[model samples]
Target: MAAAPTRIRAAVVGTGAIVSGSHLPALRALADRVDLVAAVDVDEERLAAFRALAAEPDETGPGFTVTGYTDLAAMLDAERPDLVLIGTPPSLHRDQTVAALRAGAWVLCEKPLCLTLAEYDEIAAAENPDGGPYASVVFQHRYGSGAVHARDLLTGGALGAPLVAHCQTTWYRDTDYYAVPWRGRWDSEGGGPSMGHGIHQMDLLLHLLGDWTEIRGMAGRLVHDVESEDVSTALVRFANGAMATVVNSVLSPDEVSRIRVDCADATVELTHLYGHTNDDWVYTPAPHTREAADRVAHWRTPAADLPSSHAAQLSVLLDAMRDGVRPPGSGPDARRTLEFIAALYKSAFTGRPVHAGEIAPGDPYYEAMHGGHPDWAPAAATAATSATAATSAKEQ
Candidate 1:
């Protein structure tokens, strides 16, 4: 019999809701393949709560008895885990990732990996020169069975050349949602829905559509009283001559996450709020000929129904770790998505279309997403400034 694969030792860096709800569950599901040894958080109370929560029994067996730590460096030195799952805020991602990589641990980080292109470069610089300790972002939407099928079809020319596409991530977040200190700030959460919420769909769109050449975008503080834009929209031109429109908003009541691709032979769409299964996707063939219509049957034939979840991506990452190879959603692939985001923000703030490779070293946007523009100030700050000025004028 072939030797059993070595189970990797994994550690999680945060005990917040995302970690408890997604990362911990994923580790439990893959328990046979991973040993979660430690968890870290700044808050002692939250850390204790997380330990209690992890102690709960489940089908995967008795809960993962993980040691909790307040300092990440201490956890790294003590645990020396093979894999680190980062579920912390966007601001802390660069430093945490670099620390993990230097300690010879592969990282699977949550979305909006870092605040800017420069920060991304810093994290990337920390990886092993070969490939063993590479860091990958968690873009789960690309792992679903439907997405895999669509990628094969679209890239293999089965769906014909993709000409146009639409990607939307519209969800509602009221004042209470932004009550968290880091929620609405550009420095912490990155750039609103375009970076935080819509990024999942945006990454998936880029995954299917290939490289983007240029972006023309607009953003506004439409509704919510926050520093970042409540809504953003962009027109993207791809290297393959495909054009796409992207909309990211946190102001919509009827929440939906959607992506549609119009190819020469068919139209492919996947619609779901947070996660998607095979059932959420539909492929419609152009009725130009009987043979073209007949191909729809093959497209509808279901593969293994793997839903897009943290586990799905983790499974792939685990395989890569075992093989000692770099995985998808890492290195240049991740940078592409990050660069596109920076381009969108630059275009939105500067009122000019931004191109790929335009925001390189020394570029203001390379160091920060807002590019140091006064126009990009948060609405809350701007409002307060105006109020103060009005009161001073009346007193004078």
Candidate 2:
């Protein structure tokens, strides 16, 4: 094991709900190891709330001062923290990540790195190798016990070759949910449910299944009055020859985030929304196969009770950073998830199947997520009537 930094001076940008709910709490949990040096946001009210974090520890402990800044660059120049947690809207990710890395700070960026492949590449370019600062995107589900255990079984051949899978993130997001200026805009949030919501489930799916070869899908604004699609469905083909069906929607009343992978010998599944523990995973061995059943009985499982959270991944990230290794969520690892989304969108908007690496600079989709679809436009008001007269479903 590598020796962690004696004291990591950390700063956080964007004082939104995710920052308060997950990032600040996680940082506080590591209060002994990380110092809350600075908080940056445009809103002073949010910054005031973050200022309260400095008062968390009693006078006896490391009672440090945390400064608030409206400008990220000024904070970067002043505090120069070891880590910077970015929980801002997606549109700002690229510029902020580039600036953070340039400021010699390890970055813990939120999900959906940027709105386009071009932006993704730009962020990747900012990463300085040769023992310089790095950036890690947030895909917390991949760090959960459930996902880790299931990945081990599949890779170790305990679950046999993965044949098929289903990734679903169906959550209810009212029109008011998109009322926030940046909530549903393609330029801001990237894509709708696929980028914001299902991206977590999809990241976990890709983490286990490996690289996806190609995908064909469709996206639509079925309900929510937004610039981006309210729902999206994709048929993805993995490099291992396993195909999966992906559905992301903000219209489901009974919300559920699930990923079920069926292998030749057994079926492994996980069901959870937002986060998951080891108990959320289940194993079902192949029926009527004595050899498979016998092997399944002895299959190894994760013994620890690790829950899915920012702390889970952040702790590990800090460990790696101390050891001088690039963290998990950035670079190629997180980029793959973004690439998968890009391919799915290109396929949907262009009415054609999109192979991996198909979209690049100059590609219509590379600039914007909607890919300049001729018919698609942001809805002023959600179409209340249902469009189920016939159907608009695509299955793998």
Candidate 3:
């Protein structure tokens, strides 16, 4: 008998609008490497619509088959997917990811992995000991070509000892954007610009510059009538002695996301428009020797048809799944990022600076800050309560 073909069985949870816009499309792009067997969502209607969309004839290229499920547990029990994509909101990420991991499935969870550091710690501790079915957080910007190039420069010692790092994400979010009941809520989405929007840039900053030692942050509800901050700024101290200033806001008229790193030898800067397409990345290295200047000049020519960060990360993740190895941007990687967010929130609330190692498992605020009753929109609250009651009755 012929040996069985190797296939990376995959499933996606949370068929929210983003699942279609980001995760599904990326999965479609990696169709051959992955078998997208199941999609799970709480909303049956949304799941049905997504199934239709997934089944739609691909005018662009070949299509793969996918099944839909309204129950996550049912999908996991039936499909036994090799990899699971958790695209749920930040608040639900901890529970969903833990459930999937415990159910013997690898997970690629969306960002802001958890709402609080303690929750992040709990999820991180649940990883399989044998390293089968690992989990990764989706910090896609770290996979971008420009970011790759920057990392090469930094790692190659071309820019010696990064002295200063700066990141800015200024994207516009109108009233209509926040019209969604859970859009700007602290309990539901975790936080506003910092956790939801700025996290990508912050991840990139930390990934390149190394871990941060201390952070002092301030957040404010400048524009939106939400419980969380609409604008946030943080001063970060990296373990390598590099310092960084990060600013995130949802009030800007035009979208601009960019980063600049000043090193002992030279300065490297990257500027790109929001949504991360259109060959918009600009990398400028400070002039050093004539040879270095010429090299920088050579790199300045425009390149075409670069993969989106999401696509790049997805490809890497699929390869890792197939190889049964830990992928880049692994769950631990995302957990560290969430730890920073938790520290930032602590700093914001307490009006003090927070250190990375300070958020230990035994900390009083760790578990108390998250879990228990959720802070959500009235409609969501009612629905959640009803669902909880129904589940209790079913279990009884």
Candidate 4:
């Protein structure tokens, strides 16, 4: 008798909104390659809804059973799936991912890997061999065709050396948007625009520009009652000597997400309207002889239809799990992105430039309190708050 084809057994930890919206659909589409074995969520209602969605008949009209669990530990102990998708909130990521890896399940966690650089480092250290059953953060932007093409041009020296990059990510979030209890809280969601909305852009910038050597930034809660900043801007100097300016905000009336890279040879620009969609891109080559120009133009054909960020990322992750290889956007790669944001916050509060290695694990800011949130504020901001609290107590 012929042996059954192998399929990567899969389980998802969080069945919240994103899981139902993007992840469930994407995984179902890859049914032949992946088996949806189990799902876990604290909320029973959410778990039931997601299980029902997952168990529905496929296009071929065949139903599949997806086990549901309210307790993550129990599910892991029983299923021991090959891959685990963590779609939990930012604050819970560190603990969940560490547990998943310890259970011998490879993890594909959602973006802004954790709330702080400290959490990122902790999870990275916990991921045993740095490869399989390890963790991969979901920075879906890295999978877009435009991103792939741009990376080739930048890394292949086709665009010479990167000189400067301008990144802007703006989206509208009104009072109603903060209705969720943890929506704008420092401990729950991390920070405001910089950590939540701007993370994707920051990942793209780091992927394109290499390491950051220094950063100076400013952030504030200009438009919201949230504990974290609603707007932020930062100036970064890359290790390669290229400079960049990043702007992140949720108060913009007209939302725009774009990154323009100016290289020694030419310039490349890409923009997306929504968080997950790539709308347009422009690639310009430096002036050259007629023959050279023709060749460059021939190489630069019109942009083609590309995979959506989530789809592309999911495909690569599944492929990696099956082949026993590390995905390009591993947890370590995603850590750099989070570290950059941590530096940005530190600089914003201190009014001083922060270096790459400035926020070490032992740094006071690595574990500090802001407002009522422990270890949630930027180091400098936490110090300021502590002083104020001390003064208030003295007056009493």
Q: Which structure among the candidates has the greatest lDDT? A: 1
lDDT (tens digit, per residue) of candidate 4 on 74-104: 9999998878898988888889888888888
Better of 1 and 4 by lDDT: 1
Local accuracy of candidate 3 as per-residue lDDT tens digits, 1-396 = 112137678788988877777877777777767767899988989888888887765643345578888888888888887778888877888888888888878788888777777777677677764555667888888776666766777777766778998989988899998988877875778778888898888888888887889999887778788867788888999998999998999999988888888887667676775445425545455556435866666344434435455667878877766666678787666667777877776676667899987877645335433222233223554465567667878999
* Candidate 1: tens digits of C-alpha lDDT, residues 91-135: 899899999999989999998878889999998889875756899
Query: Candidate 4, which segments miss by more than 4 Å at Cα?
Result: 1-5, 57-64, 275-279, 287-291, 302-305, 368-396
Error of 4 at 93 (Å): 0.9
Best by TM-score: 1
lDDT of 2 by residue, 37-84 (tens): 899999998788778855566532434478999999999999888899
**lDDT of candidate 4?**
0.78
Error of 1 at 331 (Å): 0.6
- Descending-lDDT candidate ranking: 1, 2, 4, 3
Q: Output the better candidate (1/3) by TM-score.
A: 1
Please say which candidate is ahead in lDDT: 1 or 3: 1
Question: What range of 10 consecutive residues in model 3 has the weakest lDDT sum?
Answer: 368-377
Cα lDDT of candidate 2 equals: 0.83
Give the CA lDDT, 0 to 100, for residue 336 in model 4. 76
Q: Give the C-alpha miss distance for residue 21 in model 3, angstroms.
A: 1.7
TM-score of each: 0.93, 0.90, 0.85, 0.88
- Note the residue pairs that clash in candidate 3: none
